[model samples]
Target: MSEHKDNAVAETVLVSSSSQPSQKVRQTAPVSAWNVLVQGIALFSDGYNVQIMGYMQTVMAKLYPKQLTSSIKTRLSNSILVGEVIGMLLFGLCIDRFGRRVGIIATTAFLVLGIILSTAAHGNTVTGMFWMMIVSRGVAGVGAGGEYAVCTAQALESADSSASLQKRRGFLVTISTNLAIVSGFVGSSIVSLIVIAAYGNKASEGIWRVCFGIGIFLPLTIFFVRMSLLDSSQYQKHAIQRRVPYMLAIRRYWRPLLGCSLAWFLYDFVVYPFNLLAPTLVSGFTKNPTLLQSVGWSALINSFAIPGAIFGGWLTDRIGRRQTYAVGWAIVCVLGFLIGGLRFPLRHVFPLFVVLYGFFQSFLSVGPGDCNFLVSSESFPTPLRGHFLGFAAAVGKAGSAVGTTVLTIALNSFQNQTKGQQVLFFIGSSISVLGTLVVIFMIPNHPATLEEEDSKFREYLEENGYDTSEMGLVEKH
Candidate 1:
């Protein structure tokens, strides 16, 4: 409206709704709540399946000691991560290109099929069975990975689509996605413990099979629910199913893109390996290192991350995503170095070790674990949201694949596992300190709205000789 305001601009609005909260909520909350709920289950299923593999590997190692080696265990554990990397990229592009609905339905099917296949995995030899399981889980992983792109973006867009939901967008997205993820991790541990205890705490053929089977429950229950999901208003209003301006997006958004991707990469790197092996770490120092004992303790460790996510989500809404992320990383960096420094003294004190260890993990959740999803989804425009979010998440999952391998390698390299755990603390801390700096510099503090950034992006495109007309009111057949 004014020539004086030249560059990309948006007015910071506290409340976009002119009507009463109840009326506004009644109109908008159903679809928003539906998306969050189903996606929560989607994330829950993803986390449950992804996490149980580590426990499966642990059980399989004990069951078929002659067949399962460190190499095979590592391969088994990383298979899903590798599959997730593939799924996120492919589904993300497709979600942007086709529609979010297609991606959601397809990924859910993949998750269900993969879990079913992995559950019933069989072969002539024990090693063959393990390989079959790996391939099966990898297939499930692709579905899980695609959920990161499809589900997260869908939830974020749902929040954006509603005026009533916009203010609480950060918290809603964080709780619905990240909290579900952490809960899934915790659920896997609990489920594994219960299943193993029922099977006499002995790693056997049935125990591994049953563990994989349970992952299918959430996904199977939510399949029809996912089908019921219509594309969000943001996707509808801004869908560019035709020729997308990829070069324009990269040119305009590269800095924040780099920041979000690196932040996600670093977050996944620390959390996936550490959370997966929490049992090993806790058991290293515990006097009673029973299968049930280690996994039960691991469940406790995973549970601590939940509060951090809850608080981080609330804080992200109040303070800002970048600020909350930075604070979390800052605390994590300090706690990690302290943990590494005191590894010797804390070796004997299991309670203190867990308190510190759990706190460290909780902060990891606070930082990139929860916030990265918000940062990735919120920082970009809605039309191309799936593309960018998927790419960033795919990059992060790639880091997770590498991190899991490296951590396992580090654990094996150390004659004393304690030393390996200490190294992990140091490495996690070092990465976190870098993350704090990156958040401060690269990550932009985006305004709270469904379309603030999207509007700016649309204007930027129209100005640059790109067709903005192709972006609005797109109906999928």
Candidate 2:
């Protein structure tokens, strides 16, 4: 009799919640194309800075050959990721507590400052230069890290606010984010071309500085634009007026939080190490390739990401998030194993390996890589969106840092370059397989409105007899 009564109560609550007409009504203004463009540009600094480091690694290695040991090089590569982890944690809270605009300006300011410092990093000794750059890049990474959380949350939340955009939210958000990657590639290419033209077959001490200097223009421009931008209506209406205790919010939604964080961690763990070390990997096969050749290969590999991102966006909206991830990860894992295991003659078919690697890297952007941002932003309530997204991104950056560090160590441990590449590929493949399992079993598919998600959470709390009086949670019905 008690069980029957409980079922009846749940049924009653469901019916009552479903019957409310206002629950379906959209409250926020439609997001404009201009908003999306600005948001995408604001995030370009992150992509540009990340890509710049990969190229800079090769240049620094050449210029400071004796001082730039394998261990120090790994640290240099991982520094930005470390900074990003910190930035995401700090700015995630600020964005949720303060406002989206405030977080944007503050984080972008950090990026600009970091870039300026990086460009100016010069020391009397090689050790001083190495540490100075590592510190500067890490500072820039903080800004990039914050942008990953705050900008993504802002863009998605803004898109969700619009009734017209709710259906296409996945595409808009993914494209906007992926544009950063594209811009990073294009920007790095241009910088590399200029450096090559100016200092062909010569070691230019200041060439890397010029590359870092060019990044400042975009972020500085975006910072000013962000200053005048309004906070998203979803955030202002749903979250701005209320304050949810961070710990309590986490306690309530720990499951989704873990899902988002771990999935992102796994995604970054595979992608970042591959991207950061691609030039070095290619250099192993190519005989005496110039800086231009390495940059060209990296750019060629990155070109696939644009189409992959678009396809992933379409797949996310069409097939649901989990399916997209499963398909993409499976493809990447198989390819990774094949690339690692293939014992073909190195010279005749090495280019094939590079192409296959690029193809799998592209697949990553389409699946977990793209959806991690979407799922992280959508899986939580408005009040907790920024915080959760930041936490997840921070975890992901942590994975990137760890992956880069560990993989670098693995590569250095092997005497033969081919053996090192094989080992790294196998490790990446295993990590992708693990990530696929997590996405399938742990993360729930979220395709509903923020209001609907909020209602479900509140209904669950009520059904479980949890008190909501102190949560500042508005009753949807």
Candidate 3:
């Protein structure tokens, strides 16, 4: 009985008599600032866990010389992406099938548990310990992976719920998603610095442990916070929770899925290899630098993305998603080509090389880094949102996995160190050019308002003999 009433209330709060989200409504809606905060910090947690592995490589090497093999480093780095691929597909289907809050709650718990295991990793032998850390981080990766799908849906839905929010949804969602994750990247550096300094710059067994452990706090806080979260109005009204028509959704959105997935693939393929292996890059560029020094440089470089994220957020709203995405990738490609072609000369002025490299990182955050979320999240309707976003993100992570793997193996195999870097620069730049084509040719230009998509989606569904009227959520009492 209460479920039916809740459904009725959802309609009143989220839609007009037109059975579409009402842009004219001026009153408060179901979504609150609290909803936005949880989603943002949740992403921040995801960022920290995934990125901390990069800087932690040095810490691991210092603490365990023989145990930290090239193969081990690569596996440890890509474990999170592997877990994410699994979690994204699993929770992606679950969210659309079961519900959003369920996925959120479960992912947080898994994340917290994974952190605990990784932080407390122990073994009779050092090899066993590294394996423990790898598996544990993978488990946490699952939780973090689940967070991507649910939090994205919730953030956009929160914005879609209210008239005022809808007006600024593009800016709010884009900035929040991009900056929050980048801040995580930055936070990993900050936390590593703090903990390393706390240990008097020693790469003790404690350093890596504390770094991984600290990631648990945010997800732990969010886990409790999400316990009280309700599904959004739009989701309550039109979510296809039962017998989801996968074939029909595919027929309608296959092109977008391919395009969005490819863009993300190209983006992550470049971003992750460079990001996770930053310590190695910096160390190779300079005289033997301490782990502390490499980590500090990485912190500064990651922080440079802040301005790019801010600018991209505003630009996506001002121009358009595809245009902003194309411009950012183009700049990255140009800078990468220049950096690769001039690697020998740039290495002379290490600081100058760092600055130019920072520019490359910054521009990526401007478009592909940030806009990928908007392009995928905003491209689909609420019913299919979680699944498609999951699939795209999973593919993107796969790209990261493949890129990270090939780059690491290639760098390790190269007789000439310079040659290895040239491959990264030239290959990565060329991939960005392809990503630009994917964006231009494949990514559709979404309407100004989400309402337009939802309306069109409903019309399409109803016309196809799907029971649009029976599509709303049936909440628990």
The total of clashing pairs for model 3 equals: 0
lDDT per residue for candidate 3 within 130-249, as digits (tens), equals: 899899989999998888898888787776655556666666776668789999999999999988989998889888888988998888776777766666766766777677878778
Local distance difference test values of all predictions, in order: 0.81, 0.75, 0.81
Model 1 lDDT per residue over 67-131, tens place: 88877877887788888988988998888877787887789888888988988888998789889
Q: How many clashes would you count in candidate 2?
A: 0
TM-score of 1: 0.92
User: For each candidate, what TM-score against the reference?
Assistant: 0.92, 0.87, 0.92
Clashing pairs in 2: none
Model 2 per-residue lDDT at 324: 86
What is candidate 3's local distance difference test score?
0.81
**Model 1 residue 70 lDDT score:** 72
Candidate 2 lDDT, 1-477, residue by residue in tens? 343222211211111111233122223343244566678887766788877877777777788899999778877887888898899999988887766777877888789888999899878998888889899999998888889877887678656655567677888788777656556665786687678668874557778888888888888876777665555544544453344555556677798789778888888888877877777777766788888887777777777677788899898889887788778888889988988888335435877876788787888888887888888888887667778888988998888877877888898898888888888989989998988888888787884566666555556665666554543212443
On a 0 to 100 scale, what is the lDDT of residue 252 in model 1?
A: 94
